[model samples]
Structure formats: structure tokens, C-alpha cells
Target: MIPSSLRARFTIIAACAITVALVLAGFMLTLIFDGNIRARAVAEVGDDLRTLAANARIGPDGRLVIDGDLSDPRFRTPYGGYYWQAGRDQQIDLKSRSLLDFTIDWRPQPPTGNDVAIYERPAPEGRRMFVLERRVVVSRGGTPTIARIVVGLDQGELDEARTAFIQFAASSLAALGFALVAALWFATSASLAPLRALRAALMEVHLGRKTSVEGRFPDEVKPLVDDLNALLQARNADLVTARARAGDLAHGLKTPLAVLTSTARQLREAGQAEAAADIEGEVQRMSRHVTRELVRARAGVRAFRRSHPTPIAPVAATLTRALSALPSPRPIAFETRIPAEAAAPMDETDLTEVMGNVVDNARKWARGKVLITATEAAGAIHIAVEDDGPGLPGDALSYEIERGRRLDEQVEGSGFGLAIVKDLVEAYGGDLTLTRSPLGGLKVDIVLP
Candidate 1:
């Protein structure tokens, strides 16, 4: 599933809403504008009809005639795009020359009473007309005569005006949509700027390149950054205390361990070989434990001070080279497989010590072959060292891991190697596991998070 961002979703919804509102408003305005133009045309035609009716007169032969000259320039010229005609018995008597010699195509029937008829009709000049016809009684010498007057105004000019308004409205609406989208883009970017800065700061922290976040952030996000910095500081202080304690503990044991070694050497000189050998072995075990603890303590202090990530591949390769330089008669074959760009959250010195110890232990017990593998998985780094030596005894492996426990009373070295591995792993928030290898030997698996 693709994740959606708040800024993008909000911008899209807002733009759509604005566009819908503008469209609705534009439609309403277009209707109102067209209706107003049509209404005014009808009103003007009605007024012209009234004027024609008022000027109606009856001649001596009972023929209808207009009292005033209908030849007023207002009537002669189509100044307002209006036309009119008045007649009796379906015969034209007077008409506006604004028609340009093209008569208004209207048939006005003699009215039954005093009713007026109003409707729309086609006029000359390819325009529509709003027509109003009325019947009037003209009295000459006390005799009443019926006459008809029809007046019309052209609707084409109104239609043209409405079309222009619609075009302008469409253009305006298009411009508004573009402006809205542009504004939304800028607003979204501004709102998300803080998140971007936070991400950059996090990257710096991850790489150990920066100890603190720096930049001005919005009020809402400042607290979050502050909390992160506080957490990092607390962790660093705790690590410092742990290192000091480990160092102090190691220092306190050195005097007793040195005295024990001296006693074992003197016994050997006095020719009590059997007793001296036993004491020497015990002394060596204590010395190894103390040394391992010191290394583990220092590893903790150095893990956070790395200026750059240590690539595991080159470290493994370097270990292979160093081991190959040892003049061993066992015909040992060293095999290494590591990724091209695999890295771990460890300093170079710490990594060298960790890898060297594991590999050296493997070389000691291996009959003919050793293998080293390094890879990354699940947000952690894994390093495995295997040797074709007699696998560790089950009971002995368990006891050796117990604090200050040794499996072999006669073993020539401190049995604290695996325990040191465990301590270093824990210091880095990682894990170390020992298991039987497929080559009928022991496999050391280290995972660093």
C-alpha cells in the first residue's frame, strides 16, 4: 500500500471544493444575466406598443392614422435595435424605418375586446423580436373604429451580450482554478517544511555525525526534537558510568592476579612441577578474565565516539590476512565471504578486537578449515565464525557462559573469551550466540543492532 501524505491530500480536497463552488456560482450568474437582458427587451417593446396606441386616430373614411409624424429619427434609425409597426384590419399604416425597409413579419388580428396580446416573433436582420399587439378604438365625429398596433424589440443584441458574459465567466473561472492549484502547492510545501528538517536531523544522528539537532522549528515540533536530544544525552551519560565502573572493577583485581602469577612461577622454580602447573593454569584463567573485562569496558566507551561507520567486509578481509601470516603447521584454509558494502555500528578498533578474538579462537581448535561470513539483516549486522574443530561440549558450553565460570581446570588460557563476546554484544545492544556448526565444530554468531 502506498502511503498518502497529509499535505497532498488536503491540497487536493481544498482545490476540488473551490472549483465546485466557482462552477456553481458561474452558472447562477449566467442565468441571471441572460434573464435580465430578455426582460428589458420585453419591457421596451411594451412601452413602444403603448406609444403607438396613444397616437391612433380615425380618418374621415374610417381609416386609422397616427396623429403625430412617426418619422422621428428615434423611430427612423435602429438606435436601440428595436422595431415597431401599427395598422388596421391586418394592413400596415405606420412603421419604423429602423427596420431598414425590412418589415416586421407580424400578423396582428383585430382584437375581440380591449385585450392586448404579447408574444415573441422572428424579425428582419436575422434577429428575434419580443412583440406586443393591442386593439384601440379611434373616435372621429362620434364614430368608433378599431385599430391594431404591434411593437417589437430585437433580441439578438441581448443574446450577444449574454454570450460575451458567458465567455468572460468561463475565462475567469479557468484563471481561478489555476491560481488555486498554485496557491495550494505553496501552502502544502510550507506546512511540510518542518517534517523535512526533522528527517534531515535524524539522518545526521543516525550516522553519528551530529550530537544535537540544530535548526529553528515550529512550536508544535520543537518539543519532540528536544525530547530526542535529551534521550541521547541520558544514554551517553549512562554509558560513561558503566565504562568507569568496568574499569574500576578491572583495576581492583590486577594486584591479586599479579600476586597469584608470581606464586605460581616460584613454585615452578622450586621443582614442584605438578602443583605449579595447576596454579599457573588458574592464574592464567583469572588474568584472561580481567583482561577481557577491561576490553569490554573500553568497547562500551568507544562505540558512541565513532566518526564514521566501519565496513565489515574490509575488517574481515584484514583479519584473514593477519591470520594467514601466522606460521601454523596445521595446513589451515581460511574462507571469507562478505558483502561489498556491509557496515556495522562499531568503531574500527572495537570491530578489529571483536573479529580478531573470534577468528583466533576458531583457528586454535580447527583441524583444517575456518569460515567467516558477514551480512546484514532485519536492521542489524550478523557475523559468523565457524571452525572444523571438535565442537564445544554441551555441558561445558553452558557452564562457561555463567559469570566467572570455567569449563576446563587444565585449560591453558582464560576461559573468558565467549563471556567477553557476550559483554561486548550487550554493550552495543546486540546479541551473541554459540552453536554447533555443520562442519562438526563450534559456530560463533554475533548480531549487532
Candidate 2:
């Protein structure tokens, strides 16, 4: 599988380029070595041809002959790899013993006066040969003639050396390519280190550990850092402005609402019962809307961004104690089974409000016992409140708790409290659930992370 990381992609590209470079370099180097080796072989053959020329002459019988023994011993060895021949008018007059009557495959061609002609022979005896030939004037015993002299050498030694060189070059290049690819991987890693650091800094900012992303970054990454910081500042400013506006709206409308309440009361005392009823109903509706908006405004996610963790045990105990004091037809017992370390990641006030509403709701319906238990696990807080009273049916569990709407008018509660709790829990990145309790009553479960 291809890696999704930028570093891996860069390494792959670099490896391909290195492989291509190695292939081209190997081809060029092999060509250069072959040319040099062939040139040296040609020079050696030319020297041998010159030696044969200096020693050759036309004998008294008009036949080509040598004045003395050849310097190279291979010239006398039968069927040896080295051989030479001398002839006039395409007729052989003298030859090396190495030929063994297996004549040189010489092709006739016009020649330059002094320049030697050298070329590779076609395959013979399942091996290649290099031939150097020249037409030269020689005289001995008062006889002169133009003789064609040719020297040939087997190419097996040069072929073996070239093969060995190719093997060595291929292995060396393979090792080099590996090293270069590895170096590229490390280089890419080092270059991306700054990006890793920047990501960590952003995480810290998100967790509220720091207000803005901070730390040293590469020049190429500083612009992003600066932009993030500016965004954070702008967000904080917007939150402040929004909070002030909510507060202002609440304060600005307080006097008018108070006056309306006062006028309704006055009308009620003056026998305008229908008018008072209408005014009171409108006022109540306005009051519910204002209260819901206030709760929502305070529970904004950004508003609680810097909130400290609030322990749940103390809050549970306090609410239990306060609720136990209320008079009832039967004495109710409250059990708070929360650990000291169980804390919710929200403000103390908001946590108190959320737990208070849930606990109170449970207390109202509990027959004789209310159980409160909370735990902290894996950076999350889970709270369960169970009551022993008659719980709602499965269909009733979907209680659409909205502002100014009560599920049952017989119940002496606004029903908006749980709605506020739900909003508050969600604002802090948490969730609330209603389920059948093991205690045979309703269970309110909340998890906050």
C-alpha cells in the first residue's frame, strides 16, 4: 500500500530518480570501458603487424618469407588464440603456425598507404576475434613486393573482463541506490519535524492548556501560526461581545417586564379579570423565552472554554442534603456513591445546575430511595441517577422537554430544567440519556469528556 504521508511520497520520488541516474551512469560507464578496451586491443595488434612487416621479405623463389623468428611465442603455437598472415595479390606466402591451416577470413579492401585497418571479425569457432591488417612494401634478398599482413586475437579475455566490470558496477550501484533512498527518507523526516511540532501546539491550544498556539516554528510555518493566533483572538473577542450583548439585552428589558407584571396585578385588583389574564399569559411567555435564552447564552461552548474541572461528589452530596430536608408524605433516603476524583469538565455553577436539575427530577418521582453514582474513567465522567419511583414507559422515555412545555400538568414543575441541563451538557461536549434503571425507576445518565 502506498503511504499517505508526504515524507513517504517524497522518498518514493527520490528513489525513482536515483534509480534512473544509476542506470544511465552504468550504461555510459560500460560504453566508455568497452571503447577503451577495444582501442588498447587495436594498438597491440598494430604493434604486432609492424613487427611482422619489419621481418618480412620476398625470398629468392618470389615467395613471402620472414628474415628471423617472430618475437611473440604464440605465433609458433598451433591453433593458438594469436595468429598472423602475410600474402601478395590475395595469395598466402607466409603464415604463423597458430593458424594450423585454418586460414584467416580476410576480406579484400582498398587500404590507405600507411594507416592500419582494424575491425572485429564475424563469429568464428564460437568466439569473436579482433583483426589488424595493412598493405606494406618489404624487400629481402634483392626482392620487393607489396604484401598484406594481418594479425588476429581472440576476444574472450576482453569479454570476460567487461563482464566482471559490469557485475561490479551493477552491485555497487545497487548499494548506492539503497543508501541514497535511505538518506532521502531521513532528510524528509527532518524537514517535516517542524510540522509535527506545530500540530502538537495546536492540540494544546484546543485542550485549553494554552490560549493560543505557541512555540518555535520554521519560517515557512510561522505564517500559519500567526494566522491561528489571530483567529483565536478574534474568536475570544466575538465571545466577549456576544456575552455583553446578552447581558445588555437582559438588563435593558428588565424594567419593561417588571412594569408589565405590575400593570397586570393592578388590573387583577380593579375587576379587569380578562385583560389581566391575557397580560399575565403574555408576560409569562416572555419570561420563559428570556430565561431560556439566558441559560443558552451562559452555556455557550466558548464561554466555558477556560472552565476548570468541578468535582461531582461534593455537589451530589450537597444537592442530596438540600433535597432531603423537603417535607414529604414518606421519609426519603438519598444515597450518594460518587468518588472524590469524579469530576466534570465544566464550571462548578453549570455542573451544579445540571446535576441539581437531574437529581431533583429523580427525587420528585423516587418512592423512598434515590441513588446517585458517578465515576471517572479514561478522561471522561459518567454520572447515573436512579430512582425507585414508578418510571416512565418506553414510549414516554422520549420526553420532548421544551421551554414553557410540561409533559404533565399534574406534576408541580416547569419541565424546562431538564431542557436547560441537556443544552448545558451538550455545550461542554457531553451527552445525556434516559434509560430504565435497575432500581425499577428512571435513570438519568450523563457523560462528559
Candidate 3:
């Protein structure tokens, strides 16, 4: 299949154009050189015919005769492919010794505007000849004799010259065409270099290595790079604005909620304890929703905007210490197993939020022990928080994790913890899995790249 690529198309076009132009040029040069060689051969033979005709004499024997000194020795050598002949009245003739008893098929033409005719004909021994012929009048003392003088030369030398020229010209032109096409390839690659660099920059942005494309670019592509950078800038600005709005809205509702909390406490002291407690419970639920909304906004922005490595050991240690100090009816042991340098590819804020929620949930349900372990595998970091408690029914494990579906409504909190952790984990391009723990309870595992 032909590749749908810019480089391939350009190379094919250049090769075709160079090949066609060189082929035509080579043929034209060969023709011109061949014509000149043949014309010179014909002209030299014409001179020989003229000299032979001028020296011819009608002797007392009444036979055509010629005695002349031709410069070329081939004229006197038999079958030398150079010859001269003279004939009259369709009878006997005089000819060069090179004829070797073979008569030229001679024909006479009436006097015309042109005195000489030049053409080609086949010769003895399968050789081709270039012929130049003229009609001449030889007058010795009185009567005139009309004679045809023809001179011929073998075309072998001209053919050899033409073949040699064609070979040299073809080879030279082929080499020249190759060099030019190679130069065109280098020029094309140099011109397209900027495009390759631009692609690398874009990939870096996508991988969260950089936020924008950088470096100088050619005029043709500069506008596209500028527009892409501008778009990233605008997106970041919009995220900042949105996050500020969420923070403001969450804080704005807190004051009214505080007033309601105060009023509910007063109602409890005024002999309406049951109704007051219900009001406090609803208030707490609303507060959890508001807090989770803030977390959601922060997770969304961090996931889309940027990424960095977050160390797992320190964050896990901090959460373990905080949860360990929390008051409980029974002593709860918090154990951490993490590699000191292990890190996950995620924002620090996101990693903290997710791990905090998972570890906090384990503390609530754990009977006496909560274990947090972190490890690296398959180019990702995995953090598992396991707890020992009365485990959920097999079918209820997934159901209880749904937002607001607490295993026990009698428990004193809204049920958005696991759901929020799920959201934050997904935002960081990671996953959260819940399964039966080896500790005889639930295991919340987080995998992040």
C-alpha cells in the first residue's frame, strides 16, 4: 500500500519529475550528436565525389574513365567501404578499386535546382552506407559526356560514435539526477524538522510533563503553537475561577449552618430533645454534602490541570497517627507498612484526600486493628487499607458503598466517605477496589500510576 505520508508523497513526486526530465534531455542530446556526426560524414564524401568527377575523361576508347588522388587510402583498398563510381548512357562505368567487381545500383536524375543528393543505403557484408551523389558534365576538347559520380562511406564509425556518446550521456545524466534528488530529500527533511519538534512538545503536555508548548517555531507553524498555548492558559484560568467559586459557596453556607446548630442546641435544653436531635442529624448530613462538594471540585481541577509525584510513606504515616489518637470506646491499633521512597503519579492534594477517607473509614469499622500497606508493582503504586471487623454480607459489600447507603443508619455519620474516595481515585487515573480482606474484614485497595 502507498503510505499516506507527506515525506513519501514528496519523494515520489521528486523522483518522477527528475527521471522524466533526464530521460527526455538524454534522448535529445544523443539525437543532436548523431545528426552532426552523420552530416560531417556526408560532407566529406561529397568532396570525394567532386574530385572524382572533375578528373574524369572520355578517352579514345570511348569509355568512361577517372584518375584522381583521393586523400583516404580506403578508396583504393578493395571492400574498404569507401568508393566512387561514374557511369553514362546506361552502359559501362568507372569505379574505385574498393568496389571489388560489385556494381552500385546506380540511377541518374535529370538536372534540378539542387545538384547533389545525399541519402543512406545498405552496402555489402551487411554494412550500412552514407551516400552522396551528383551529376557532372566532363568535356575534353569537344564532345560532352554526362556522368553520375557517387561517393559512399560505411556508417559503422558513425554508429560507434553515436553509441559511445549515448552511453556517456546517459550515465552522466543519471548521476546528475540522483544527486539533485538527494539534495531535494535533505531540503525537505530540514524544512519539516520543526513539525517533528512540535509533535514532541504536544506529547509532553499530554503526559503532564509540561503545561504548554515551548521554543521557537517557523512562520508557517508558529500560529498553531501560539493558539495551543493560549488555550491551555485559558483552561487553567477557568479552573482557578471555578475552584474559588466552590470554596466561596461552601464557606458562605457554613455560617447559616452554624446558626442552625446553635438553635438546635437551645431546643434540646427547652424540652424538645427528640426534634432537636433530628435537626442536628440533618444539619450534619448537609455539612457532609457541602464538604464532599468542595472535595469534588478540587479533585476535578487537579486531575485536569496538572500532576506530580506524591510520596506514599509520609502521607500514610500522618493519617495513621491522626486516626490513632481519635477517641474510641476500645483501643484501636493503627499499623503502617510502606516503602519510604514509594510515590504515586498524582497530585499531593488528591492523594491525601483519597487515602485520608479510606483510612478514616477503616478506623470507624475496625474492631481493634487497622493496617495500611503500600507497594509498587507494574509501574504503579498500590495502597491497601485493611480492617478487622464484622464484615458485610457478600451481596451488601458493593451496595453499602453507594452514596448515602450506610450499613447501619444507626451509625452517626453520612455515608459519602467511600464514594468520595472512589471519585478522587478515578480523577487521578487510578482505581479503588473493595474485597474481603485477609484480616477478616474489608480491604480498600487503591492503584495509581
lDDT score, residue 59, model 2? Answer: 71
Candidate 1, pairs of clashing residues: none
Per-residue lDDT tens digits of candidate 1, residues 196-313? 9998987777667887777889999999999988988898798789888888888888888788878878988999888889988788767777787787778767766444778988
**After superposition, candidate 3 runs with Cα above 4 Å error:** 1-5, 50-60, 68-84, 89-104, 107-114, 125-128, 153-159, 200-212, 246-300, 303-345, 351-449
**Order of all candidates by lDDT, from best down to worst?**
2, 3, 1
- Give a tens-digit lDDT track for model 2, residues 215-254: 9998999999999899988987787778778888988888
Where's the lowest-lDDT run of ten residues in candidate 2? 401-410
Candidate 2 wrong stretches, greater than 4 Å:
1-4, 40-104, 125-130, 149-163, 270-282, 301-304, 308-344, 365-418, 431-449
Which of the two, 1 or 3, has more TM-score? Answer: 3
What is the lDDT of every predicted structure here? 0.77, 0.81, 0.81
Ranking by TM-score: 2, 3, 1
**The 10-residue segment with the lowest total lDDT in model 3:** 406-415
Q: What is the lDDT of residue 269 in candidate 2?
A: 100
Candidate 1 regions exceeding 4 Å error are 1-4, 31-175, 216-231, 242-307, 325-329, 335-343, 357-449
* CA shift of 15, model 3, Å: 2.1
Model 1 lDDT, residue 118, Cα: 73
